[model samples]
Target: MEDLSIQHVHLELSENLEAHRTQGFSNANALVVRRGAPFRVSVQLKGRPFNPTTDYLRIRVSLGRLYVLMPVTFSRRAPSSRWSAHIDPTTSNKQTLFISICAPASSPVGSYRVQLSVFTQDRQRSAANGSFILLCNPWCSEDEVYIPFEDQREEYVQSDSGLLFKGTPMNLVSRPWSFDQYEPGVLEACLNLLQVSPQHKRNRTKDYRNRCDPVYISRVVSAMINCEDDRGVLKGNWSNDYKQGVSPSKWTGSGDILKQWAQSGFSPVKYGQCWVFAAVMCTVMRVLGVPCRVVSNFNSAHDTNDNLVIEEYYSETGQKMNLSKDSIWNFHVWVECWMSRRDLGSEMDGWQVLDPTPQERSGGVFCCGPAPVKAIRSRRIDLLYDVPFVYAEVNADVHTIILGQGQVVGFSKDTEKVGSLICTKAVGFPRLQNITGDYKFIKGPTSTISSMSSTMSEDSTTSRGSSKGVLVSLSLDKSPVAGEPIRFMVKVMNKQSVTKRLKVHVNAQAKEYNHSPSDTFWENHAVLQLAPMEVTVLRNQILPAQFEHVDEDILINLAAVLEDMSSHERFLASEEFNITSPELIVQVAEESIVPNKDHAATVSFTNPFPHPVSGVLTVTGAGLIHGKTQFRMSTLRPGGRIEQNVTFNPSMAGVKMLQASLSLSDRNIVIRGFTMVHINRV
Candidate 1:
């Protein structure tokens, strides 16, 4: 008889990672592989050839208290949702033996310790130890998060850079974001997010078990993105004040936020908005092997009472008031992840909405989602995981009212304003893909205003005036831009066959993109006299000096009100617009970009304001640059232009985006721009 003791075990990291499509994560020393796939390991014997009938082997995989032990046999079978092990007959010799191990597709994703125990006649003799990290499998058909399309998998799971749509639907702005899932310390930080979660802290075994499902994982990540409940990743700030920490707008990538959180001993990163929260959540999901994308809902409503309606109040002078708790954001961002809803049936399985912003609580925690998109489209609010909340966000009706002396003077119902548009980044492109049809059915415009009673007596008013009342319309003469005066026109028409004395009031207020209007920035008042059937067009311009002190990227609410001097009748029209910041020009000098080859690009900025301006220019790209490059730009006078050159080497092959942002001094403004580069494989 021979000892048949195991000498050493080798993990075929390169071969297994290549097969698992996780080659990008090979920077770690430990073996990294996706679940539901088989990985090879070789074992060397110390003494003699092992006979399968007498000498046996058992493989044990464990994470904390949860462990799975399986007998090594000659059974060469297809992999399934079960732990199995077998010796490779073709590679086994007298001194060394090759073995393949498979973790079930439903296995809990995390680091696992692999141990091989040798036995002779059921008695333990020798053992060997190894380790590997297991992640969710989007490429495996057996995985619940499996996506069939290759292009979509590459875009959602593999691509480290993306675009977040902001601004209004009429004027869409593609804000570039670096997912940076594979950046140094980013993947580790993503895993650390799970470790710091309240669920994992409460019960490690149960949390590990629940991670096998994408639904559980999404819910946990959603709550952990905000610091309201747990010591999460980012702190949300919508008050336009970021003195203590970095502003949410300054973040161009998730790598810095994640690393900051981890380095600070699980403290929350400062200042995040809706888009920032969604972008960071998308990065964590992608790093954990879940297909995810950020989505923007234009005119998204926050129905506080679950009534499927949002009430808005306005003053008699057309100024919007914050009297109601419910509000409508110009745009609200959230993430949609691809996974199967076994708990909600196959029909409900598909893209599910997971909002990371801490707007509301679910299941006694500040987490929301795993709500199926189909369920929301079907108006099935009875389902689990905050379906009614998301349903109201996109399908709620809006009631606009005007109050005078605590009485309703005017009222309008707009059925089409809420969720006018929904979109996400298109696959393999840097453009917007309209997904509005997925959330709701298209209906005809249904905005109607109730007839208001004339303040004048019937005998005093003409039939035409009583029938049509006063009609007011507002229009923008040109797109508003920073350092340029905003020009717009207000048209007021009188239909009565009588001379009328009227008072006109125009108000402009600066507001955050996701909140209600703040204090008025500019206003105008005038007295006008109109003859019978006469139209008045008032052209107005708000100079850059008037709003230069206002915050950057904030929307301007320009409203006009016409009051009948005698009748006391009021008509209101308002428009919400944003001042477009000057964009940087990023031109890649290389005609063809290949992996590991140096490339040069230029970042240019021209001062459009009349005064001198100085700022810091920061350039970053996930696969194109090593980290981020920052340069302090000197003060440039009016009409002065400056160009900074950047040179870097591409690390991987894929479609990469180079993004630049200029943060100005003496003002709160951030100008951003990006250009796409297709890097070919070396």
Candidate 2:
């Protein structure tokens, strides 16, 4: 007899086996069987050690041409073991079970290997590893073998749920992947795939907010703008060729018709044609789910040209279309979109003309020629579409058309029935031609007044008297130092006229350190003049004192006070010019020294001028003691003096070279009566 001992037996299950069992046998067990023999296999389950009351088992054996396996079920109340009788024993304690087999008498005989598998709700086992084999008669005919081929017509079996395919599936051919190939349904499929996983679903909200594909509406709007110069010829023609066949369902009545045309490849120019084109394009964009509007202005100037130009178009008959150019007749048009608001807030409300014409008369029109075969001449105005115009002042009668949610549709020198209109009051513009006058000092409460004449038009008038009696008093809460902020208040009251507006320009100039003998003081200027009779506070930091032992002058220059104009042709004072001190000078004193310990000395400083003196009194020299170096002082008056004690320590016992100096502004002045001392150490 051959050795039949089983070695390395391993039992595994798909899920927890013990938790689902309550009877005579645990699901985690291996089965032993013999080849070429029929055997009855039975299993009896025993309850867990703690609960031994239940003992049950069930085993079934069947022989058929085909095999169908179902999950094993358990009933806890049943206590007896179930049995099936279908086993054939060929040797001592050696038997096998004929699970399923289909073979004819004519089949060729050979040893056949078969795999027998058993499955429960949570477990599965197979016996194919050197455990099972079948032997057939050597004289069996080949006709007994059943093998299927591709020649049979295959049909899918349909149930209440869905179609099912039979037979083994073949591998599909490979191709390159493309995102564009994904259909609308693919998006839903992707969403479903993402949701199937719990972890992915948990992060879905965050991913949607951060990684969601943003719609680039600007690209679509850019395509519709169509700023080509050739389409400018279609301005105002309103022909079918110039109009885009947009469905009314897409566009609202308030939309610009010309914007629609331009977006649909109609208008292509900046002047009249471009305006009309932009209007149509805007309308078309609105129809395409993009809300848009139009804007119009008169005497508009282009930044490039710095002048205003009229927008005109040539007819198909080679005749020029004349547009009104009078103050009331000049016009311009531009289109804007709501998407701009998403990117640019309130500024997006303004219209951006597709092809903007130059607003200046000196600027020429942008020329455009048709293709060689078309033989057409045209011009396009290239204007920035997204620029914002915060303020607009008109001096003539002008008409503006607003379309598509308050978008300006048309700007015309000529009034249209549906457009907004505004009229400007006629007034002469201001100009400065000549300002060549001499300054003269006068005594008394008023400074000298010079007669000034202007070449403004006779109809022009001036009001508000000069600020001749204005007085500016400067005070400091605390004395100012170099690199510190100084506060000042300017006061003006006495005025020749009260009705006129006043504007003042104030500047301060001082002598720079190390200035050449011929070089005057450098003047730093600042202007402050918005309201009259109101005190204006000014703050500034002072530069470091650059010169020592010398007088420095601070000069304040007040420019001419301009007054607001009235109905009559005359000049009046807006405020009085009562500046108390136009210039202030202060004298810095020389340094004097007193002897101290170990060749150290104390230096005193005084200010000769009545005004307070502010500066750093630093003492620097070679072989000076550490921590005895620099000192800062402020507000030294005419009779007040500040003393600073400094010590010098020589490293070696010998005469040490020492030099004391003071830095004021950028100039360095040496202190007198200081000598090198010889140190003798015993």
Candidate 3:
């Protein structure tokens, strides 16, 4: 009986990983496979062929003290929720037995030990020992993270490079991001995120068991992305003060951030905003085998008090005042992970919103969602995981009020402005896809702005009210460009037949994309006389010098306030716009890019500002370059052009992007550009 033992075991690592759609994780140097899928291992018998009646083979998989044993069977049966093992009839020989093992779809995702035991008449002998790392399976139908669409699964779970939509809806900027899940030490960092979690520290057994559900894992990831409550991955900063750490806008990929975090003994990496937090979380989720995508919500509201109304105040002179805790960002970025929600039933089993930004606390922790998108569309606010907070983000109402002498003079309610657009990167493409309908039902065209009199109470004003005897609208002739004056026209019409005397005050303020505006940088006040039933257009211009010295990439808020002298009624119209920055030009001279071959790329830019500018130019690529290549430049005169020649060797064959950014030394501005290079395999 001792002679009938196992000699050696061979794990078909390459073939199994390819079959499991996990070829990208081959760098882990372990048998990395997904759950709910069967992997094969060949066992060579030392003595003779096993007899089914007198001898039996069983497989043991264990994590710590918890273990499961499954007997090898010849008969094939339907898949079940338990561990299963069967012999591959076509590959079995007299001395070599090829066995297939399938861990349940609900198996815990982590490292597990595999042992083969041969049982003879009265004794069991441990024959071979091996190990594997299991991940969530989006390809398995029974798995909670299963996504039906092949293209979607590939884009969400496999693609390493993506685009994060920022700026305003009108001037959308598709910022390139390197998810970098396949980069060195990133996957290990993702696994480390789970190991260092509070749940794992509190109760190891329970944490391991709960990892089987994507919902549980997502909640953990959401909390782990922000350092508000735990020793998480990234520390969120919205104050535009990044003196102690790298600025969030300067991050090109998750690889450096994750590697830095792990190398620093799990210390929180400083300075992440909405997009940075969302992009980093996407990398972690994709590394863990969960399907995830970054989504941008334009005009996203932060309802601090959960009242579903964001109150914004403006002075009588059209200067925006920071009088309320609730505010609306130009755009807010978050992640949506695809999974099945058994707890909420199949109706709620599609895309789930998981925001990692520490905007609001949930259950005493700064994590959000696994809240089903369908549930949000249906207004199911009672669901768990901060659904109400997310619901208010994209569907809240904006109450704009004009305060004069401590009295509300003019008021308006904008129901459509809070969530004008919601989008994500398209599947299998490099463009934006509108997903606004997924969050809220589309409403037909209606007057988004409704103005009211000072006598109307805030609660009594509805979304259908109109201004008394006047109608106002703001319009821009063209998009605002950097180094050029921003010119816009404000049209105010007297609806009534009587003539009206009015005061027209226009205010221009510089603002961060995610926060309220600063003090009024440029404002104009004028008294105008409107003839009976007259239509007048007031033209305004904000010069380039007025905002070039502003901090960071910012937006300009242009607001106009009109007060009727006869009736003392005031109306407001405003436009928020982003000034387009100059882009860097990247040119690769070679026609065909090959791996391990030196390539010359040129990064060229001209001074777009009025004064001389000097800064450091940084170029980064995930798989194309080893690390970032930076060049410091002297002050170039206005309209002066500079070209930098960069040489790098391609590490592997794929489509890679070379991203370049020029951060000005004189001002807080970053000019970015990218060019895709498709490499040929050797």
Candidate 4:
């Protein structure tokens, strides 16, 4: 094959339901459908209509190497149109052809090559040659899941989120992770993850069970894709690569991760966190004919027990203690699989939650979920697998244990924060759909949260305590760069009338974020005296070595211990900061360039990491190299310097923005830079 071209075919469920449209112009693009369903498509042709040699036009559908041709058939008021031997346009000149593909009820979901044109024994011409994805609809078979055309373009094929690396995951509903699933590497890796190799199979039936069994397949993929098992493809050691200069905070797509895994002789892809694990799992599930979407739960809880209560111990000085297994992550990413739980009743069907992050064990295995979110929200712990654990993640109550000298002091109850902003991509669109209300129902037989609760201790319930006399808080700087001094602030206010003498101790620890808390990495202490109702702010700086631990990944945990010396009462506050490396500095040869004049953009950076890394620098903006340019990069040794120069000419004059990023081959690491220049008219 010398070349290939892709064209988009605007598809809709019906003329009335025009809101549902699907099209793609790359191998990475596809029109998704469910197998054995009334999947109909109206093909609207782009470009000029070709004169047909014959009276009848035919559609040649190719699956693998096999090809079958069917004549373009549809009922119109005029019967002559279907009977005509040459199905070319009449004088009226209509280019649109209506195609109703009748796939059997049990047709295997996959991709197919469809060519719509007028063909004869002597020759054949191409009108529309494109591919489509057949997804498994285990529910009622009528395609309830509607995928928008924009989603097919950006959400399915484009993997990077609009937000840059180290951006907060809190406001991610505004950003989309366009996952390009059709990439060759991603497709291959997905197929390879199945137990039965695709090459060894005779046809679709060879491994139908291993391929379509949602429960079994999900479990195998959840474990096998993460190196929790020796047979897994990727090792999910989070702290290893994340906090270090490596590991892009957000994943680009599945292809890069898949490519890296293959290069390592199938050794596990290194150091994936929850989002990385979830994104890869989404690709695998989608490629395997299972419809999947990545979901982000802000303030998601990790309930250690079946109980939904999350308890936290804190020193009277406001320092949070790390004693409970119950905790809430700022945000958690997991995948929701669309499939019928045939094993369960009709009520349990649809949208099964499958977490590939390996947070907790299910059935003595490192895999979790296939547990129905409906079951979890409905408080149906009676259902199979891990419903209770997932319920607590969304509905756990927070109990803050305040203690002085290792004994419990006054307690604070916080119901805010955990399990809010539960969202997923809306159907038939590329925006967020908040289904938080789906989990907000009160607990009962009708109570989803309470019924899912197997046990509730006294600590589980609490009435928030009254405010303490003084206020003390600890906070880290917005962005702390590695190899530099990190700054933090301690704010204290003595609201009482009398003077206050406060003993303040601030400790900075390097913690392995994805796992249990590690030992303290550094410490600082100071005592202060303040006048009545005085509000004082103290700023402190920690040396680079203090928070930089030997672990490949690190999180700076700052704890502030405040003591009222006169009363001997204490309060505690803490904050966590993810240390980001310095930005990749972009230096342009000149600040101004005339039209048609070439200018150089030198993207320079030093590898702050210990190992050698290879990557590509991509430059893109409105008027640069047809709007995009990619330059391959060589590997750089530890602490090596890279000053890549890319030259581009300004065809038009104005202010132009240049966006460049140094992205590693596997895309585990990415450093971004941007520059704007005035383009002088020649």
lDDT of 2 by residue, 321-433 (tens): 23333222222344333222223333322222232222322112332110110010011122222121101211122222212223322122321111112111111111111
Q: Cα lDDT for residue 176, model 1?
A: 91
Tell me which of candidates 2 and 3 scores higher on lDDT: 3
Off by over 4 Å in 3: 1-8, 44-56, 94-96, 118-126, 445-468, 588-600, 646-655, 679-682
> Relative to the true structure, how large is the alpha-carbon lDDT of every model?
0.86, 0.25, 0.85, 0.58
What would the TM-score be for candidate 1 when compared with the true structure? 0.94
The better-scoring model by TM-score among 1 and 4 is 1
What is the C-alpha lDDT profile of model 3 across 330-369, one tens digit per residue? 8999999999888878888889999999988777889999
Candidate 3 deviates by what RMSD? 3.7
| TM-scores, one per candidate | 0.94, 0.18, 0.92, 0.61
- Candidate 1 vs candidate 2: the TM-score winner is 1
Global lDDT of model 2:
0.25
Best by TM-score: 1
Q: Cα miss at 4, model 1 (Å)? A: 2.9
Report the number of the highest-lDDT candidate: 1
Error of 1 at 466 (Å): 12
User: How do the residues 1-682 of candidate 4 rate in per-residue lDDT, one tens digit apiece?
Assistant: 1111113454443431211121211223345554543444555544445333343456666555545566764332232112111222332233555445544334444456877664433454446676655545433344222233444333332322222122223213232232334443555455556533322243544444234356766777777667775456656655454563236344444566776776666667666777777877877776555567777775678887756778877554444568887776756778877656767876877678888887787777777888887898788888886788778778888776667776775454556546655777664444566666666563333322111111111111233232336676665554566557777678887767889898887776655444344566677788899898898988999876555453323455567767778766666666555556445676779866887777888878787755577888776553443435778879988788988787878655544555576776643445666665567867
